[model samples]
Target chain A: MNSLKPFSLLKRIRERLDLQIALAILCLATAFLFVGGYLNYLRAQEQERTGVITMVREMVAVVEGNAAIAAYLQDLQLATEISAGLQSSRYISMVSIDIDGGGLVSTGAVQSGRSPDFVLELASPFSAAETVGSIKVYADLDYIEKLAASKGRSVVSGQLALLLLVSVAILWAVRVVVTRPLGSVVRQLKKINLSDEGSINQISTRSQDEIGYLADNINSMLSAIHAAYLSEAEQSRRIAQLERKFRLIFEGSHAGIVMVDGQNRLSLANQAFQSLVAHLDPHLDQQEPRPLSQLFYDPELVEGILSTVRENNASVFRDLKLAGEQEVWVRSLFSLIESQNSAEMGYIEVVFSDISDRALIEKHFEYGATHDQLTGLLNRRGGEARFRRQVEQAQSRAGSFVLCLIDLNDFKPVNDIYGHEAGDVVLKEISLRLKSALRADDVIVRWGGDEFVVSMLAQSSDAVDAVGRNLLSVFEQPVEIRPEVWVRVGGSIGIATSDRVGFSIERMVEAADEAMYIVKKGDKNSYQVFGDSVARSQSQA
Target chain B: MNWMIKAVWILLAFSGSLYAGDILVVVSKDSPVDTITKRELVDLYMGRSHSLPDGSPVMKIDAPVDSPVRAEFYQALIGMKVSEVNAYWARLMFTGRATPPMSVTKPEDVAGLLARNPSALGYLPEDSENEQLKTIFVIKEDQGAP
Candidate 1:
């Protein structure tokens, strides 16, 4: 029952509109019927009053005329009979005789005291005659009663008929004018679909009434609301689609991307970025935020990036070494985000895009330009630059260094015998052996086809000679080109020390060349150092 | 000329007697029975107002609709005029209380209804009765004539 209470109350209220309308109509009809009935009653009463007055007046005239007739006859009994005859013929109640100054004569019925008040007077029919015996006549009001009753009934019945007809007409009119239109509006409102575009159906505006105006306004409002709803829904749908596309781009990009805030703290790092950092510095995989400074081993590099960004207010791209181990070239793009009030919110963006492959390719191009392609060593141009820089530094510091020149003795014959391809392989193998014999700081150059040079920085002339002998001993073993073929390639070496000879890089290379020719003239397997005599002889020649 | 005058006089006297003996009654067309008992006739005319003793519907008839004869008959029987009867019926019909009596203009019509409908109650001159229709009651001329 408690649960049903709300439902029942709702039902009652829902039924109230029609119920109230019906009740209002009933009340209006009842009031109209009552007013009409009362009016008809009043009309009948008025007519009855008028009829009664007229009948009384007519009865009085007849009574007066009869009195004159009675006087002319000069017979009391005959006059009485004449009055009785008139009374009976006319359906009058009574006719009476009165003497000149005294008493009454004959009467039809002994009159009751309850008789209605009447106007009495003496009269004669002739203008010039004395009043005869006065006659008292009682007015017959039965006809008035009958007339009033008939009129009252007719009026009531007529009024009732009129009321019935009018009430039906009014009820029908109200249903059409008010109820039906309102019901239609309600039904349309219920069926209105907020999702569909142009769903609002226009209501009629034919009438210039308040209801018509209200419907028009409501329809316009609904149309606006529906349009707004559809527009917002469409915008949100497009936004969702763009968001999905952005997510795909962000997640699927191969290049590592890391977003840094203005505070130099890592804000967002994509999966690629995380993997890149892990590859560059395995320690970065620890559960801690790596500062940009810490990610780069060089403080100067970090400061350069920050200063560039601060000065230019733009992005910076450079090749950077990660923790002094791995070199990753990255292009960073940064931008500032501001609020609507134009206050700087923060910096957001990506330091992304691995140009490592590009960097490797560029390194290869640089290496190709500076080094010989076959022997994997510095060419003449690169070797000259290295010799000059080393000599200049050694001269300033009173340091000693050595330069060696070697020319392969049987290289051309081996190339002519086994073809140039085997010759190239033999050259590559020789370059590998020479690199292995020398220290990392020493420079080896392929001077030309079947010719090579080596440069080494040293502390003294003895150190220079030891390094030169080690270079000469590396070619003592015969090189193997194939399983059955051992190619015994040999080269004559000539060494020159920077402090002892005191020559420029080119002059030192010329002295070493002269010494190398002496070795070749003696025996190809041996080596010689350029002494002051050889240099003087060469200068004189 | 004297004999012709005598013959016309005889004819006139006969017609006068015939009319004096005749009466008329009227009833509604939908009345169920063709004849009524004497008791039912007395009750209906006298306004005693009861159904027929045999449990049939009793319908009282009125005289000529607009004639003085209607006034006289109703007045003699029920102490009211034709106008009063109409008013009574108007009140009944308006209030949804009762149906009004039907009316016939001629005595022959009354006699015919009486012959056809057993529950029909009406008045006629005493001399108007025949084997086809039964007389329920007789009233002297002073009582009422229609």
Candidate 2:
């Protein structure tokens, strides 16, 4: 089974809140029915017991009445006549007369040896002058037993039927009150598409319950997310603008732009820094932000430059030497730019203009440092800095977002079997496909080789899935590097959503990378959402 | 004329034999074997029982299912109609505890069954019995004997 995506499941449940509520109601109703049935059963049993006891008591009363009459008859002078008269009564089973001291003077035709299962009563009577005799009567219990049994059976059956009906009604009621509503909510939640810019705002719940309150909260959260996304988008646009402006400034300026902070950290190294150091280091393009100490071979020369900048607190122009064996001409100008926030001294801007014949070569190296050689995608360092700035802007706005790490599935095989030239063509084709699949707001950076990083200002996971699927579909067709040899490769994509995975770019990338591996393991042509088990496994391994 | 006279004489002789046969109470063979005097039998079949002097289990049986004799027997003893006996049995059977006495389709079947089982007892025509069955007690046609 595909590993459960908890966020997707949560989304689905939220959409169908009505169904969940209805189910809960149904369960509650069922419970009520059971309890009601049990109570009815208990009531019936109690009634049956009481009825039986009453029947028995009534039988006893009949027996006692017969016994009293029999006793009264025995006291009379005409005991036999009275006994004979009592015999006329149809219900009397037996009648016996006994003297005060004598046992059983006379008994009716009924036998007496067997134990009496019927109700029996004995009573004595007294004459005016003296106590006479006693009499006993038996009242058959079979009739009472029959009556009670029939009544109990009917009552219990009736009660059981009532309980069954009530249970069904309660269950139906629960379904209507809870399950149906919950199902509606769940259906709505299922329709939520986080990838759509305005989709989150469309969620509407009209209930006055806790679910309604939750829906309202979710709506506000979506608004917050949308606002954040817009702000982040604006920030990215600004960063691009700044990068363009910086590129123009670096290339167009006659004076070299070398920007350094108080910590000796190089902020920006324009064309002049490269020119000044090119002769001393012919491979100056490879030496990025070379420390002032590394640039100067003599430690005393570096100390002089540092002291001039520290003491003057203004522009300090000085002539510096090539750091190593190759002697080069360099002019260094240092000026402190005011800190954007506090007046505490900020980084010093150093301008190094090369007035040497190597200036043309250094200019070429500077262009290569910032620009990507292949596909024109941002290089690793440039992409990282841009991504960090974007993340900061995104964090300030608290927007819903996604980060995707994409790797070509079969790019390695293409390079191994077909050659680097064919592999490069495939990579370019993949880059074009990725660019076409993304929105203008999204950023696609070729991290290097076969890997690309994409950042989207999407509102939901579904948006990420859509973009991933689009990229996958675009790559599905085989690329014809030549008329003869066709290169077929797939892309493995991992997507991490900001809302679920949080707002950290590194974490998002990690999750996406993991998710991408999942795509590779499960379906090479598909995309996997990060932090959704499939992706995490790739990260873990 | 002579044949008609002879037929009349035969009829007279048959009637005379029936009248002299003592009108004994006959019970079916499947009846509960009870030895009851005329008064006691009258009381039992009439649904009257003060007590049992002999304390023997008593059950009463009637003639064939639709026989007029059965109807007359219940009327004379219990002062109730044959239908009343039927209704009584229906009520008794409805309780599901007790069953009415076993019935026979014919008086002869009753006699044959009674002759085979000692526990079987029934009042039959006085002259109809053979030596196989015993008559412990007799119920006179009239209430003259106790």
lDDT of all predictions: 0.66, 0.61
Choose the strongest candidate by TM-score. 2
Stretch of 10 with least lDDT, candidate 1 chain A: A532-541
- Give the residue spans of candidate 2 off by over 4 A: A1-43, A59-66, A69-121, A127-228, A247-257, A261-290, A340-346, A357-541, B1-146
Tens-place lDDT digits, model 1, residues A297-376: 57577756765675566666655656655666565554443346433344445556656775578679988888988777
lDDT, candidate 2, at A125 = 19
Residue pairs with colliding backbones in model 1 are B23-B125, B33-B117, B33-B118, B34-B116, B34-B117, B34-B118, B35-B117, B35-B118
Superposed by TM-score, candidate 1 places the C-alpha of residue A227 at a distance from the truth, in angstroms, of 7.8
lDDT digits (tens) for residues A71-148 of candidate 2: 433323334444555544544455555555434544345555744333333542111233345545443345445544
Candidate 2 lDDT score at position A446? 84
The TM-scores that each candidate's chain B achieves against the reference are 0.59, 0.59
TM-score for candidate 2, residues paired by index: 0.39
The per-model DockQ list reads: 0.01, 0.01
How well is each residue in B1-146 modelled by candidate 2, as lDDT tens digits? 99999998887687542222233454334435445565555445433333344554544555676764555455445556668767755633433433455667887776677666544445565567666666656434452222
